[model samples]
Target chain A: MTADRSSGPALAVVGATGAVGSVLLPILSQRADVWGDIRLIASARSAGRVLAVRGEEAEVLALTEDAFEGFGPGDVVIFLTPPEISAQWAPVVTTRGAVAVDQSAAFREDPEVPLVVPEVNAHAVRIRPRGIVAGPDCVTAAMIAAVGALHAEYALADLGVSSYQAASAAGRAGSEALRRQLSLVAGTDLGEKPGDVRRAVGEDTGPFAGPLALNVLPWSGELREGGWSSHELAVRAETRRILELPDLPVAVTCVQVPVLAGHSLTVRARFENRVDAAHAREILEGAPGVVLVDDPAAGEFPTPADAAGTDPAWVGRVRASLDDDHALEFFVCADNLRKGAALNATQISELIAGESA
Target chain B: MTADRSSGPALAVVGATGAVGSVLLPILSQRADVWGDIRLIASARSAGRVLAVRGEEAEVLALTEDAFEGFGPGDVVIFLTPPEISAQWAPVVTTRGAVAVDQSAAFREDPEVPLVVPEVNAHAVRIRPRGIVAGPDCVTAAMIAAVGALHAEYALADLGVSSYQAASAAGRAGSEALRRQLSLVAGTDLGEKPGDVRRAVGEDTGPFAGPLALNVLPWSGELREGGWSSHELAVRAETRRILELPDLPVAVTCVQVPVLAGHSLTVRARFENRVDAAHAREILEGAPGVVLVDDPAAGEFPTPADAAGTDPAWVGRVRASLDDDHALEFFVCADNLRKGAALNATQISELIAGESA
Candidate 1:
């Protein structure tokens, strides 16, 4: 099984039938032709299913220890599993000398695991002593590249972000739950009065704590003490780590909107020096992995629907902060399934491949 | 025409059948039993419709010059009409010696007309040289009380706010439009991909610039140059004026969410002195017109659904910025039809009654 080093790394995709995995398969087929054998691994129930990638059908393998029996040191495994699954499987892959690029939050804070956004901190990928490159949670990965680009030139001092996250951020189950809830309450006057929403969407709030169809829920992820949600805490930490601003003054409020795919954020950034809308727009338009769609008069700005299925983080509504000369306010949106989760993980794996070769 | 001054002033509600007026009439009846004659006036089409107030059916009258023909100095008028109607009729009422409390943006920036948020700047009500007091826009009025309360203690220097505005902020038509659009797209597999929303909600986006059923539209109000919406600019100006920080740095983004009644805001405030979340929570808890709900672990934070019929602005998610000791970040939600529009207007009228008596 010794292929030439130049033949490229063997890619193994764990949780290949999950939400991000479904999205990642198409992206992998479309973007990375450098992989030798693209292996798809899922739970036992999905193991016999065939998934189409790059115009070819790949049989999904059951994700057990025996599945990786053939995996070698030259292999790169991308995990799109739950935190518990990643916690169980990631070390096993890395122990077999394969690089594990995890999309779970399980190993993100580990000192030996390099939490990375390739565009923002590719250098961190090379320093992973645990052979693990942790992808940011979908919320942070959605906007950090664009935010990081601005911070690079402006010396970002503080960030205030309000996220309008999509249903798919919680994966396939979350999306299905929203769809089910929407069917129960849509076309009805559920939002007309207080408790009306509660009455209409009774006992069917789904994976979300509240009904998200025709409504916005201010809390996301697991609830933490002092009214903090785990998603908000993770976004703050991930963005801080990716931008290398460990003490970055970042206040994030994660609110789940009814969008199915893209995650949208309204960001207020304070810089060390004055920044104008024109200069910010110029920088954003030319920034890597960022698309600036800002012409308000033409009714042009990024929305979750507009950013859905897109790879780049779309930035718009760029304005100079009227209250602070050093601050810039803008909106950012990206596909939660794409750049926000799967693509970023794939990019990290590609970085490892380039380095190992 | 004035009987005993102890009997209280006459109250006329122009545009009484409109969305804000409908909400205001109920609040007026509930809060102000002092008003003598509560007149309900609307356009000819709605003139004959009877609306219930204070447990009685009040007959709506046509909003004509003749409607105010008997109005005198001892009378107080509340204008919940659109800006155009307010511009035409607010001056007419003032000329007839009646104090006009306008909820519309018609007189907000007029030098002689003081824009009043009673809890924040009630003294401004007595200084109305034009015989008119203006109320803040629904968006600003919803959150200013909480922000103002904190500012009174800490000297707020800068503000960044992102508003999660509801459909009713655009009036009854806006709410109806959202309902219709939601019926068309919700639970229908519309928001799964880019442009899927547009394709599904075709030609039914209504008063909104885009489909607002399950999607969050970043643009609100009429578009302005440099991508600022009119609502954002109005909030900035009104907030600065009410807080008496004439040059206060304010950056606002008004986003239309799918909620029906409550308008929510995420505010980041920088003060002149360091403020902690615990201290901020204490001030917010005792602040007039604010209900502090900060226990996130019990899912106790406010959402639009929770604030739908409430009078007070619900405040929560209070967190002191880790980067700036002087800055505080929090979330606020209020009934857009109540505190945002009608109740503030009603509060201003009560001020006129107490002074004129």
Candidate 2:
């Protein structure tokens, strides 16, 4: 049943030494069915590092235009670097007939690129005219994948999102660094100064900009001019794009909770098309990569603590939202590393194998 | 400073065996200068129990007519039982010629019963129509205490609220049970049937009614015919009441995060009056019990971790909500056990002391 390895697309991974790439290496290396000759690429600091790819040591190569010189045409390349780095070099890879599956923000909004979540909208992967497959932001990907499953049964008109995101989305440094500030906040010697929350503000100055250990922080990222944070704006735009709601009215407040991994969202979606709770449940039950963990009667739900290492976006708390006939409320959780980033990037690569290579 | 102890009002606390009672017990007893004489009452289960009150071991008495023998007219009572129990016994406590500070759903909607959060509407406590100072729901007290402080600076037209609550709000049994289920969900072995969130649905059923340890349950209670959960409806109604916005439209989603204490809210208040981020920060700085933790340059914010054992509602993320002109978004975290319930109930008693008993 083994296919000829020479006929498959050669896979190249960018940013192999970084946060998500550390997990990506294991997943990509183990996924030999879709990858031909795998290449591990990182920066100068990690140039000589070796990763276990398909149980063999794959030497990490520095990311450069010259690095792709020996690779054949129509190869599949996965980029986990920053948007600027991926944007600057993605074109070079694509120009040489490589299908670029990006985990960065580079090609997501580009009209020519198709930001695809294979579980939600796999059909979009087929129309990547620029040889680039963009992965949605982790929160956006986790949400759209869950709600999209519900949309199959009903049409959503208004979207209200409240995100409980972990510090991890800011990357390994931000989340890990938060561990200190959070512990500090939690361990604050309130000692009967009436231990007000504002005092924690006076105690903390680094990493999280505030304390994060045991508290819930509603403010995340810098406040944009219009009051939205970078995270909030990304959610609104990315959701609109993925749901194909060009001018959809979406309201979102993205908060940074004290969780260590995964992102959880409290969403109330109103659809123009009416579908009762039972029908909606049936749709989610049949949806791909959607784990319906919503048995509220017993207090079952989908939280980051539960979704940390899981591949699917764990969705629950599904029921009606408001008094409106069209609205539905649900909670969604996904391991930002897996479904939000690495797993999605890997899923897009399968499409790259089907398309360019 | 030593006033005649018998000169003040004789106070009684019903449902003193509950979580809120557990916290209020020490606050009321140890700090009785704000009060006169204190009596601890509970259900038959806790009747014989001896709890430390006012630095003395007070005998817990069952809530019977005989308990009201010495405490005659012009005394005070605080009911901390469930609504079903409170509704049945509130009138009884009030009829005993005492001001009843009730912490139940009993009289929240009753026009005669003043829903009170001492910070926002402590003056409202002065006019207990039916001799009952209604302690608001924990959700309302925490939000209104914070938002009411903000409301003084600006007139809000509408509000968007998202609550990150703990299981303790459901009761001590509910909280302890959610903890047990979470342990099971995390430690349980979900074998080949992994992708399905319910690898073993009935394997671990605790007080949460489902697996709640690592999950976010969106429906805090049963979804009524109209769709909103009991928690959601109560939050919305309580917000409207506490803010004195009978017509103020609030779209709310109550999501239960797996945190043990503190209820955090991500709120977007759309004001009728013009307000800016800087002005809001400036206003909140001087607002009672509010501490400005907004410093985006350093990634600082107020979190539940920081708000854990604090007495005040911690507010941060004071910015706008998307493109709405009237909208301002913020994060609020306060110790659910303290500010959300017990501390609030204790604060209400302070108002009782201000009166001639």
Candidate 3:
């Protein structure tokens, strides 16, 4: 059955019950009405459930071969599912003639599948040979908008990033686990001694390596080669691809903090030319999708708590490196479920929609 | 009124009522007995208080010009006081012929004073021209052991560090503020929105620039010239001085996390020689004052909670940088009060006492 094309192209959101998808639904409703029909698709478990989108209740559809029967050409299907799921189904969605804008790591490293950060490399989306546009992971997505803006003005040469990632970056399970762990540790002095927190949070670490309630875990994704976590390498690869600096000399350390939402990153970037802090601040002040909240003297700087539920990546603690005139250091935070995943995917879909127009 | 030096040299601990002092008293009792009298000195407010040391209760003495009267040569006075207090009283203690081992930033940069990390620069304590031995700040003290160990093997060329500093790094008030804030926000689901945390923690941020509960503040210490925090520059300066590398390139970003005790750092170090992850792990495992807790596959890496109350700096997540053969990245954690402050001070004092013996 062909969906009506008179209104606009149809939009299908896979994994609609997941963390990123939950944020994406509200974002789509809140943003411009560019889609003809918003289709919510999730696992069979969540299929019969009704969710609110664009302030209207919509019944979720189950994932199957027929899910994308009528999603063709101008229609955009966004997969906020796990990598294996996206890898298996993204090709199916694209085979049906719809462009799949995947927010999974599966296609991000695929050269033919353009990794898009709309503000940074929206132009790359037009040349997706695999008919799939991949979005950077939450850590990279949280800071890329600001990093890209700075790179534009200063010509970024080398990048070093350390992330304070939110539990939600691991999906709903991670957030729920953190909440559970917090309840177990709240109003207690569990963090004072060795293994005390672990003893209190016995065997319920959820998606993390250990109890993340009163502690910061340095390990993020699966351990990759050379002891780097997959998430760390993804940040490096995604940043390189998005900024078109394949050999940008990027080093990243991904750590999971106890935060429930926003992902924060401390970025150290070396530029080809001498960088001025004031000029960089001015550039960030005017940059799209970047907010400069950097008045340290007045107690103003981006914290995950302040940046959560926000769309733009909040940048602060801006300073030129003391040892290198060409380097700049700053802290940035953005809601992992929003700008870090949902909004970036939404923006890419909008770009594709505009292309069809 | 000279202390009986028959048992050993007299030891004075100023700021005995403060955070670091609270930890120091326990350390003195636990370590091998090396002193005749363990003097507890604090402000007049805590002058009447008694604290335990070497299995006995010791009366706290008020800070005065005469507090050092009985403390002469062969005696060591350890200052865990604020910089201003140390600056005001260290000379007095030294004038009476006692060696003053200060854990404040006041004398750290003094040309006549030697900044010592006993494990790294124990010999430097022998040449204290000002009769003052300065200890590095908590953040620097926490990671220098591991960094110094690695440098000894590879000859470090450049350093980049991002800290997950604990609340206690600011002092007892910072920890109290975090506990109070945590009680306010715990189990209430408050971190999902912007300023909700700030609203819940109104005017109760204590020593921090903003709410540290469920948030990470990128700024620590006083804002310095060129947009650097005093704490960040201190890490750079202290690391350089302790390593005896005056021209080493170092960059640091100090951030306050909600963890109550231990401080964590993600480090990127470039060495003159090529680094191997397995070999680095072997080196760290055998290095003095360093504990290797790596092995991400088994869910064993250093987290603040696990490292809290420990004397050794826990090093983990060892990996040679994929891009640079000479660079290595790792995460390290240490109790900010113990290894980061109290223990380091005690170790320096031990060295000073050994000098007289």
Candidate 4:
């Protein structure tokens, strides 16, 4: 283990040039009082790139064990890399005594690693026996925070959700690829015939199975066992873990929409007891970290355009289920980069720093 | 009443210059053996336009009482017009002794006017005592044809559905407006911030509350009492009517995606008995007007791109809900014009013509 540092926690941000990282740096700078000495680290190829943060320029450093050399027990190392990279480096950093907060699927299911959403399960962060705290996937992070508040008040029985995911959730390459296809088909009359848009955007489909310019794809993540898409399984697993509903009956169908930032979901949630829309709206309105924008007649409701770049989950369209007295239907949207990924990691990092202090 | 013609039933198409009409014309020509003389009729403003059908030019006639002058018993007039126009003209044609196949919501809820999805409830078409047969809405037409087949074998108790609707479901103006907004935002970096796309497409939000380019609107049709959009109400009402489940418990959340033609839905249905994926697939593969394309590893799934201009509802992503033995989840897609609107109306008209013959 590395020698302990008596000073306040420093932050080493791995994958500092990634899609979520780009958004993370800005948020960190805006919440500058949360830490001391922030280190920007990325792959060797992006090491020399300069990024602006809080009116200061920081040159990206190559990611390696040496990058965390000065990061001791009091310091926190945050990983925003893909699953493989996170798996490799999480133990590396935590072994050297610095707490590792992983934003990848690498260690999310690890029994010793605490899978956390600050607003939903901050207590889970304190029980990190492996010195590793794992944030939920982008979809789960947004959904859990929104519903966890309600779950805390009214015990949830089961959940049925359909997601409208944005392109940015696939990272920078995904957003760029979706934009390229949009530009290609935006000028043509490709939406008229079968496979027209798909043919027009051939090979530029980019991280998606079909053209998303004027379409929605019902699949996300790699195909997995039992015919579940990686995303479908992840959503079910992570949400179940974070909500502490070990055996919760959660049904999730993830669909990729053309939005570039926010991830939206339509939720039909059943509670242990009867729930009313007005009371539910009241709970959501007063709930911390959730914005209630559900006045439909006034044209106020959550949309990706309204939620992008925001930290709070925008909750709207609250109505009691027509057939069930104990259920409610609502819509939720959060900036996939902010609350869904970067901000949640930032929140977890701050929680660790507070504990150390 | 107009004089009864001994010649086989003449086919008259109202709203023959709209988006569904543009698709309906070709379908009618391809199925030319179903009719004798075909009359194209539209509002006065669209009269005199020459449209080609069955390799022959047909002049558009002004929609007036005289437009149906020679149409009588055994003759069928299909109304592909707006709900308001269908409401105004449906009784006029039916009173003149012509079977009026209305593809609008105006007559759908009327007990005498059967709302039919041909594959699901063709027998309901014969019970149109008011001489008016109404087809289901675009979203319902696509989904009912898919699920109703399964419901026939396994009784459905409740359904949870979320629709990913195409812009053309809003008709030509809606689609043109959506395409225009898409063109405006497709070239801009408008998705990174709140209201950026809305600002970029200022005042071009046309028919929809917000810009649909690279985004989705959670509400569709008019905002109704109890905060349910007209679409949400229509989906529940129509699905129940077509499936012959007068009190079937259905929860629907309709979101307008950016697709131009096909409407897709993710449905979770609770049945009266146990259901499995393999059996469901086998059932769907042989079900009339349903195409089973659920092999995900081979990347065979339904998207609007594949369903556009297709006649059958493409079913995919079938899985049994993990917690419920009686529940099944699946995704369905179909051309909103072909099966959703024009084709269903055409089918109903043919059924009426066949009975009269």
Q: Mind giving the per-residue lDDT tens digits that candidate 4 earns over B1-357? A: 333345567889999999889999999878845677889999999999999877789899998898888787888999999889998998899898888999988987898888987788888887878888889888888888768988988999999999998888888878888889878888678788987888888976778877888777898878887678888988899988888899999999999888888999999999998898889889999888999998888777899888998899999999888888899989999999999989998888888888867
- Model 2 Cα shift for residue A4 (angstroms): 9.5
> Relative to the unseen true structure, what is the Cα RMSD of model 3?
1.4
- Over B256-331, each residue of candidate 1 has an lDDT whose tens digit, in order, gives 8877888888888989988988989999999999999887777678888888988899999898776678888898
Displacement of the residue B266 alpha carbon in candidate 3, Å: 0.9
Give fnat for candidates 1, 2 and onward, in order: 0.70, 0.29, 0.80, 0.71
Candidate 2 chain A, run of 10 with poorest lDDT: A186-195
TM-score of each predicted structure versus truth = 0.96, 0.82, 0.98, 0.98
CA displacement after TM-score superposition, residue A227 of candidate 1 (Å) = 3.9
Query: For model 2, how does the per-residue alpha-carbon lDDT over B122-224 read when each residue is reduced to its tens digit?
Result: 7888776788777777766667766786688788776777888766777787556654543333323321122333343344534454444434445566655
Candidate 1, residue B229: the lDDT equals: 86
Runs of candidate 4 with Cα error greater than 4 angstroms are A1-7, B1-7
Consecutive 10-residue window with the lowest summed lDDT within model 1 chain A: A1-10
- i-RMSD per candidate, Å: 1.6, 5.9, 1.0, 1.1
lDDT of 3 by residue, B143-224 (tens): 8988998999999999999999988888889888888888888778788888899899998689988988888888998888
True contacts kept of 1: 0.70
Indicate which candidate wins on DockQ: 3
Model 4 chain A: weakest 10-residue lDDT segment is A1-10
Q: lDDT by residue for model 2 over A212-328, one digit each (tens)? A: 433455655556765467767777888877778777767777766655577888777878887577778777777888888766555566667667777888877666644456777
| Higher-DockQ candidate of 1 and 3 | 3
- Alpha-carbon shift of residue B302 in model 2 (angstroms): 2.0
Identify the CAPRI category of the predicted complex in candidate 1.
medium
